[model samples]
Target: MTLPLEEDSRPPYLQAAEVLRTEILVGDLAPGSRLPSARLLQARFGVSSSTVQNALRVL
Candidate 1:
């Protein structure tokens, strides 16, 4: 699940959250499903743990 990070004014956390929210809305991520671990998310998104946490908060 490698998603390209867009170059825009939005913060990295918001961008990550948007990607995740889209997946949920599109049914790619089913309701009540377990989300990937923060470490995995950080590696996948090339972001820091804090960024992943912020993204999860947004979700």
Candidate 2:
């Protein structure tokens, strides 16, 4: 899937992880906030289940 960010060469999971990580680091995703479910993330990122899980694992 194509992401809004300009990173292209990375794996899907890594790409998703980088977006989430940046959001969290920049406080868009707060410390105590609950993240969306894996299924939701999968749908949102248009990626596979494994990719969503791998992205969550990066957090």
Candidate 3:
């Protein structure tokens, strides 16, 4: 899978966080929604497990 965010100055974690945050804000990912697994996020965003953790923590 490809990250929705790409080619920006922000770090990968921050980028991923923003993407997820946007989804939440727009109701695409509703409140109390279960996020994708860290492994899935890592695969989707091409980032490390720690990066996915950090992104999830941002929410």
Against the hidden reference, what TM-scores do the models get? 0.87, 0.82, 0.82
For model 2 the TM-score comes to: 0.82
The candidate 1 region of ten consecutive residues with least summed lDDT is: 1-10
Model 2 Cα lDDT, one tens digit per residue, 10-55? 8888899988898899998899999889888888888889988988
RMSDs, each prediction? Answer: 1.8, 2.6, 1.9
Local accuracy of candidate 1 as per-residue lDDT tens digits, 1-59? 54455655688899889989998999988999999899999999899999999999998
In candidate 1, list every pair of residues with a backbone clash: none
> How does each model score on lDDT?
0.88, 0.83, 0.84
Instruction: Name the top TM-score candidate.
Output: 1
Number of the predicted model whose lDDT against the real structure is largest? 1
> Between prediction 1 and prediction 2, which has the larger lDDT?
1
Q: List the residue pairs that clash in candidate 3.
A: none
Residue-level error in angstroms, candidate 2, position 19: 0.4
> Tens-digit lDDT track for model 3 on 1-59?
55645568787788899888988899998899798899888888888899899888887
Please report how far candidate 1 places residue 46 from its true position, in Å. Answer: 0.3
